[model samples]
Target: MQAVAIMKQARISPQKARLVADQVRDLPVGRALEILRFSNKKAAQLIKNVLESAIANAEHNEGADIDE
Candidate 1:
């Protein structure tokens, strides 16, 4: 199953958020969270929150395993 979460009209610009998003693309969820956790950019926290919500949706709603 697949689920999506979106955040609109964020205080940060798209370009800035995209920079952080790009870093996590094609990475495993665990690795992505690790990178975001220690990231220096302000956008990292925002992206991390959104990513965590997405992961929760996938796990609780879709019954997907984190290691999947």
Candidate 2:
């Protein structure tokens, strides 16, 4: 799964973005969602959106379903 964090009209440094993105990389769907949900960082929301998209893609393309 891929998690993308986008900064728009914000003064976030690229290094910080990369660091946050790295934290979410290769994490399982559930844990990643939890991290994004409770995180106070703005980047976390962007990452969460990307992660949700990835999860949806996995469900549609890979036939992997996340247990709700």
Candidate 3:
């Protein structure tokens, strides 16, 4: 199952957000969070929040194990 969370009208421009997203594409969640935590760009923080929310949705709504 897949859980997706999207943030619209972000303070950051689309171009900048896309750049951050591209960097984490195909990366594992743990690694992606690490990269976002250390990233110099502000967009990283926003993306990280959305990612966390998606994870929560997957766990709570989809009843998926975090270890998976």
Candidate 4:
């Protein structure tokens, strides 16, 4: 099963989001959320929303086990 979620035309720069994304690279979902939650950057908040949406989509549409 597969699912896709996308956020478009966000009012943030790719460079700024990349900084936060790099920190979460290759990390688990829980750990990434923790990092994003504590981050005080605009880009972090945006990226966090996207990540959460992806998780939800995987769970609802794909019936995937998020804790695997």
Residue 23 alpha-carbon offset, candidate 2, angstroms: 1.9
Model 4 lDDT per residue over 1-68, tens place: 43467889989888988999999977888999999999999989998998899899999888899886
Model 2 Cα shift for residue 45 (angstroms): 0.4
Span of 10 residues, lowest total lDDT, candidate 4: 1-10
Cα TM-score per model: 0.87, 0.67, 0.92, 0.88
Model 3, span 1-68: residue lDDT tens: 57889898789889999999999978888899999999989999999999999899999998988777
- In the range 2-65, model 1's lDDT, one tens digit per residue, is 5577777678988999999999988888899999999999899999989898988898888889
Q: Per-residue error at 7 for model 3, in Å?
A: 0.8
Total clashes for model 4: 0
In model 1, the worst 10-residue window by lDDT is 1-10
How much is 26 displaced in model 4, in angstroms? 1.2
Model 2 TM-score, all chains together: 0.67
> Model 3: residues >4 Å from true position, as ranges?
none
Residue 54, candidate 4: alpha-carbon lDDT: 88
- Each candidate structure's count of clashing pairs: 0, 0, 0, 0
Candidate 2, residues 3-33, lDDT tens digits: the string is 2333366456777667777887777778878
TM-score attained by model 1: 0.87
For model 4, the superposed segments whose C-alpha errors exceed 4 Å read 1-3
lDDT of each: 0.88, 0.71, 0.91, 0.88
Candidate 4 backbone collisions, by pair: none
Candidate 2 positional error at 44, Å: 0.5
* Each candidate: RMSD: 1.4, 3.8, 1.0, 1.8
